[model samples]
Target: MVVFGKELYKIKSDRYKKARGGWSRIIKLHCVECGEYLFDYQKDGAGILKRLYFDRIFKELPKKPLKCKCGQLLGIPIIYKKEERPAIRLFSGVVKK
Candidate 1:
């Protein structure tokens, strides 16, 4: 597990391919109190790639809380594949007010 600011993130690789292909597990946590989100990813059971990517995204994010319309903080947990590297697929939906 990796701690980033107020959130916790972790990644675990499941399988690997010969030609540099693999499945990675991503876990992200959002802190309602701090209104911050932590993103994580891993490849071939290694965290190097995930760490670098997380660091880059964190630096690019604004120093502001990401809150819902009702003032509740929003946290998104996403899964991404190398084939879809930059795009995150949401496994859950937001709660309805």
Candidate 2:
């Protein structure tokens, strides 16, 4: 299936499985600069996407400093202190949901 102008790949996510009690949605992530498909992500809750946890990612990505094929620096990997987990801190306005 295709969604958001990209092919969709449905994958099960265990991130926050217990905490959210299955309250999550899979979203198609794209690069704002070139409109390139980044990856399919499992997102929780509702609001602007601040960051992406490593475990919630459906596709494997390069280590740290995530970038799109168009050369846009999308995000940088960091340890989310509040959640005490590994995550990618997204650059504001660099990505499209």
Give per-candidate clash totals: 0, 0
lDDT of 2 by residue, 1-97 (tens): 2243345655454656546566677787899999997888878766789889888788787667998888889889988997798999999999887
lDDT (C-alpha, whole model) for all candidates = 0.38, 0.79
Best by TM-score: 2
Return the top candidate by lDDT. Answer: 2
TM-score of each: 0.21, 0.79
lDDT tens digits by residue: candidate 1, 1-97: 6564465655333333223455444444443444444443333443333212323242244434434445664433233455433322222333220
- The TM-score obtained by model 2 is 0.79
lDDT of residue 15 for candidate 1: 32
